[model samples]
Target: MPKRILEMTAIEVARLREDGDHSVGGVSGLYLQIIGASRCWMLRYTHLGKRKRMGLGIYPTISLAVARDSARAAAALVQTGIDPKRAREDEREAARMHDAKQLTFKQAGEAFIKEHEPGWKNLKHIDQWKNTLATYAYPKIGKLLLSQIDQAYVLQVISPIWSTKTETASRMRGRIEQILDWATVHGHRSGVNPARWRGQLEYLLPNPDKVAPIEHHEAVPYEDLPQVYKQLCAIKGQAARALRFVIFTAGRSGEVRGMKWQEVDLFRAVWTIPGERMKSGREHRVVLPPQAVEFLRNQPRRKDREDLVFPSPRGTFLSDSTLSKLMRDHKINGVPHGFRSTFRDWAGETTHHPRDAIELCIAHVIDNKTEAAYRRGDMIKKRVAIMKDWADYATSETTNPA
Candidate 1:
């Protein structure tokens, strides 16, 4: 007859070993042992003629009933010819692979920049891409795994700003597409880049061009030129003086604001705006009108500064936005830049000057290469006459009858 073995506590099991019961052969059939040191039950079994062991946890953590139940489950797997050890190892490997596949959109974006930033034309181009992505895309999708990204999430990022800030949204979408493309090619993700527009997101979102149509360039009408010019002249401020200088010289805001005392020759009645300052990167000379000359002469001279005629409050070069804001503050609607168009309109309508002379006065490239190559003269005489007329028209009374 087989002898029955009672369940043992951790203390009883330790005492059994201490009593030197070496001939206790029936204990082998008992599948559970209580480790005295840890006060935990362990299950021992044999599968395919090989011995195996599994922990059933501590006394308090795994109750006696639960331990026996768990041991029966492990035994069932053994009887079915499965190795629980190998199954656990496979699960761990799968988890690791899943982690590796998960990468955030921000991570992909940084990788994209690293790969293609070197091919960019210049540092400014690279900075533009980085700034746009950081400002718009990163906040929304930065934490989401690359594979998890979809069109809805991308739309969420862009739609809020799309109508009001079309240009920024357009550039942001392009940057996101570039990053997702990089992720797809590198095997971090698979599928159409969510940022793509052609077939993917085209129907979902409003067309940017339709949603935000371009407003016509703001310019004062040619007929209202004299009255507007008079108003501009009557205004007395640094900004007004700067505007008058820009109109008188027919130069861009940058060129006029960047002017220096050394660039001017008061005796010669000329201001030589350098090639770098000119939009065409070719040096151009302006014959200063008597009003422009007097305006410059009356300006309080700085004792030490070499460059920058229109300095800010700290005496550095004025920001490019300064003039635009000044116009806004004064409620001068139409394009502040439309002043250039106004000048062009006045030149065409009021004078018999050649097209090339007007274009040259505005620093626009004379498109006819043959004429450009052959025409060496600067058309100074005609330009001088044009400048005088502009000054007269800007400062004089309205010619139109009320």
Candidate 2:
């Protein structure tokens, strides 16, 4: 029969040190130290006629019982002709691969922007993506791996600012979802994107549009328009003239700022804006009213200038914000763009002008295709009448109540 070794305590081991012989029972084999202070458990093993040493664990922390269990498990692996060290190394490699698949949310967002920014029509869109994401989302989960980001982290990023800045928060959520979806499809992440909406995240958050309704540009009442128009006329500056031109042509600030002298036909009382400058990317001819034509004629022309009806003092075109700031400085609460809304309100409430003709005069893309196709001539005669009425009303003493 094999010798049965008794369980020895720490105190007994210390006493055995004085006696010059010590042995502890381990599961796989015997714990023996050939010399004092050089303590180790030797697992008796022979593989293919070569002896091997398997150190169990260090003393104190690795208790006698646990060390014995570890030695026994190591021996079992050897018995099955498997190398335990190689198995541990394989597990470490798998852990590294799993970590490699996860990407930080900020990293994925930047990648998404770089891939999609070139296709965007507006240059401001790219800046908006960077500014909003960096300000809001980056501070929260910028370091977290994409796969580790759950719905709770997404909520934390948006919920604080969601109510106050509803539209921006809504856009932020959409951008976050887009990046995460890209990560999932590209094999950098697994499982559903936590930022997704519809049935998935609908239950988690409130409808953004419902929280903050769309705000339309407030239109000046037609009755008060003459007073406002006279106030605008009272102001004397290049910005004032540019703003008046925008009001007269019913064109956007970009269109007015980008207008060239060549497009204006003074003899014929017309201005034909080119396709590139126009928002619709279609050439639009504006039938200049007597006031509109007179305003352009009185505009001071710079020497050696070839183009640009509204050139700055430095001979460059005026920026879009220049006229808007001038309006605000002059105590005009609304802006030059608000004049378009003012015109629409007057046409709707105070004038007999047809809706299609008014929309066409303003270069608005009317949805009725057949009507648009048939009305190829732009109803110039009717538009002339409408413009004359608008000039008269804008300069006259009239008031729209409410």
Which candidate comes out best when scored by TM-score? Answer: 2
Candidate 1 lDDT over residue span 276-373, tens digit each: 56655578888887777877878766755655566666777665577777767777765556778888998898889788988877878789899899
Q: What is the C-alpha lDDT profile of model 2 across 1-402, one tens digit per residue?
A: 223266666655434443222347545454644355555545555555667665655555565677667777767877898765455568779999887777898888888898987666445678999998999999999999887899999999888988999899889899888888899887888887788888776887788878898877655666777787777777777777788777776778777887788899999999998876666768899888888887787888776465777888787878868887887787777767778888888887888888888997888877888877776687888888888788777767523101
Which 10-residue window in model 2 sums to the lowest lDDT?
13-22
TM-scores, all models, native as reference: 0.53, 0.61
Q: What is the C-alpha RMSD of each candidate to the true structure, in Å?
A: 10.7, 9.4
Worst 10 residues of 1 by lDDT: 17-26
What TM-score does structure 2 among the candidates reach? 0.61
Per-residue lDDT, model 1, residue 207, is 86
lDDT over C-alpha atoms for residue 159 of model 1: 88
Candidate 1's TM-score: 0.53
